[model samples]
Target: MSVTDPEPTVPTRDQVRQAPKVLLHDHLDGGLRPATIIELADEVHHELPAGDAESLGRWFAEAADSGSLVRYLETFDHTVAVMQTGPALTRVARECVEDLVADGVVYAEVRYAPEQHVTQGLTLDEVVAAVQEGFEQATEAAGGRIVVRQLLTAMRHQARSMEIAELSVAWRDRGVAGFDIAGAEAGYPPTRHLDAFEYLQRESSHFTIHAGEAFGLPSIWQAIQWCGADRLGHGVRIVDDITVADDGTVTLGRLAAYVRDMRIPLEMCPASNVQTGAATSIAEHPIGLLTDLRFRVTVNTDNRLMSQTSMTAEMHSLAEAFGYTLTDLRWFTINAMKSAFLPFDERLAIIDEVIKPGYAALAG
Candidate 1:
């Protein structure tokens, strides 16, 4: 699967859909189904930009493709508006799991800021509880095939990071698996939440920070050195510090070398990168270079609804753009499963029993 190889034949949608996948970076608010959004909005008496499901879906895709992050993020306003109640939150979470199961995602960690969903008088703890209940019900309904975990996120520009971090630790044994900081990456750096990061560190809690997406190496450097991030959320800008020589060799700066040597997982979202202007296009994404250099790269759909992407679509695009094989896809899947925030024993069990065997079957 070298970069110079001719583009591989694109896999059919069905073939890609059936291949077992692992997703690490999907957002709960960003992945609501359009039909569900319509129903929920109507129930809450919230007006939407589009009247029907199909038009709403098209509107999201078109708005996200407008080459502006502000425009892209604005679409979430409608989704968050209807998700303020308990029933709506639970229904969305359960349906999200069902959708992932149908798309062949065996393991997924969906993230969201509990603060964003409390506008309708729901407490933060209540919001987390509702989502957890929904996930448990969905897993049971799916016959225990798909495993879902929640990563509680704190809005970076807000001042409630420490509160959210504590809330995440409180729900660790329930359904919450990790903590995260998300929002504008350019103006608000990870260091802004140092108190929250320190509290998480003291509690021995795990967290991944949003860095290197809209910002450059400085943000990534601070996230690693200052905030102590375990993994990078859409850390696409780490490539800025790497220099490729004329002889086709690569050199890494201090920060890049530290990240690679430490094996910090990079949650790279290809289609979302293009939508958010993180990358020019999928073909020019740094994922190919990072994978070739063994950077512990993993693929993800940051926002399935807004980007109009899925785990299968992301994998297919990577295969077509970088000549990836079934073997390559398997490696990426294993990388994500290994980097997940599950307990060590459970994580190893999935890799040994489910993910490895699933990929073996696909290879045959």
Candidate 2:
């Protein structure tokens, strides 16, 4: 009797990490190395919740998992405090790119607010320059293996949005990919930054707004309709527009229908959603429904340090929860690439060359 050996099977983590990925909603300050944070904090005399790198990393994870938005926002204070000067910003940005490269990310757009990093006597322009320099340094160090872009972000509650928007426009050719507005969504809505959005639109620039995570459909509606967002950040709350009948019929509300028809991308961060109380668990997350319905959905790690997640971990969790295969993971990667702020030709080239071939080899 001839017996066939079982097919090779390894942890999904290995497969997911080997796949080329595209990330569009990551935060620079949110992805720093724990040891680097401690060192930087030490240089600046900034107080930290934990003394050692291991304890500090665990502290961030636990604090973020507390299910309190207030506590979640509090974590950034520590990270942002350490990233004040040019060298500190350069180190963080360089390490951020190196980390993404190690995670097998072929392309990433990291967003940060220059206004937040200007408290240490550096001009907003200097902060942008420092971060760009770091990105350049990382690119050389990677031997040009990865492509990194910046999304100059403006805090929604702050008054420097127009300035940030203009800065993004000015740096369009110099590593800045687009503009973004991020902050607490409860009291400060996207509408508060209408002028900034209008300016970006007029300049033929791209911008994504944080919406539909902590808030509801109204926030998403304003981001898409009023603000003309190119994409939705953490748009998990858009699930409210979807209804399932007892008879197993799925119906899309008008807003949902519009979003699906328009092919708008949803930057869904499953781990971050769970940490922020957006969803009770990954199994119950709306990503499964949205993916089923063929929405333009992209998986992202919104805050790596806070969520204690990477692309590999996020894909592993989703695969375990939803029974995803290499094909499903490839679909999410392609969706993100197609929705990237890069030009159509560049996005298409990566999808056709890197992403497609990389997945094909793994799928085999």
Candidate 3:
């Protein structure tokens, strides 16, 4: 079964769903259940483009399918609109974990900007508490089958990174895992929030930056070098720094080589990238080249509702596009678990106890 073994079978959708997966860069607001959104909207008298759950779900996917990143983000207004109150936030977070478990996710770090949820007079701390309550409720209901954590994200366009960073650190021991900065990356560079990053670093805290998605190498360079980001959220544009020669020679630019050598984690969301014009399609995604180059690349569903995806769906798509096998899927899962913001011992426990055994059973 060594060198002469036949090629491994490409995993089917159901098989992939049965395999344990780890997610590291999903958005909380972007993954609300359409039905929940409908009910919550009705409670607040908020208007929706579509009335029924099915139609509203379709609307979110179609609206996000626009190639412009800004346009893709616009679809969140409705989902965020209804998620104003504490109960609404708790419900969404609870259902989010339940959905992940059903999708075979064993571990995940879901992110959200608390600042975006304060429209109805809830303080940022209250928003965090509300979401944590939901996560805790769902985790208990699942009997600890799936481990989930909150990643507080500050809107890059806003000047509240310091506050969000402080909040993340304050709640780190409770349920929050880390901090992040997200929003349109064109005009708002990660460097704009250097004070927050510096403060986090001084406090020995962790954070990831939204970089290299809508922007190019410059954004990624700043996120890593200037801001000291622990991870690069949707660092798809790093491909621009890689050169594939006509004679099959591959050259990595200084920044790209440094990223690879340093073992920086890139949270690549292929479908979301395609939707936001970061990549042409899954077939042409830089994930293939980056994987071949041994970069610390991890797959994620940046927006589940918008991309109409789950961990299983992402793995299935990669299998069809790249002929990934169980072994390949296992590698991606382990990478995400290892790069998780949890303590090393806890991360290792999940990988060895849950991820390794689950994938081994699938492979067997």
Looking at model 3, the pairs that clash are none
Q: Give the TM-score of each candidate.
A: 0.97, 0.96, 0.98
Could you give candidate 2's per-residue lDDT for residues 1-364 as a string of tens digits? 0022122232378889998988999999899999999999999999999999999999999989987777888899999999999999999999999999999999999999999998989998899999999999998899866889999999988899999999999999999999999988988989999999999999999999999998999999999999999999988888899999999799999989989999999999999999888899999999999998999999999899999999988988988888777777888999999999999999998999899999888767
Model 1 bad stretches (over 4 Å): 1-11
Q: Which wins on TM-score, candidate 1 or candidate 3?
A: 3
Q: Which numbered prediction scores highest in lDDT against the true structure?
A: 3
Instruction: Give the 10-residue window scoring lowest on summed lDDT in candidate 1.
Output: 1-10
Instruction: Find the candidate with the highest TM-score and give its number.
Output: 3
Model 2: lDDT equals 0.91
Better of 2 and 3 by lDDT: 3
- Candidate 1 per-residue lDDT, tens place, 12-129, comes to 6676678788999999999999999999998989998999899999999999999876778889998899899999999999999998999899999999999999998999999999
lDDT of 3 by residue, 92-131 (tens): 9999999999999999999999999999999999999999
Candidate 2 regions with alpha-carbon error over 4 angstroms: 1-11
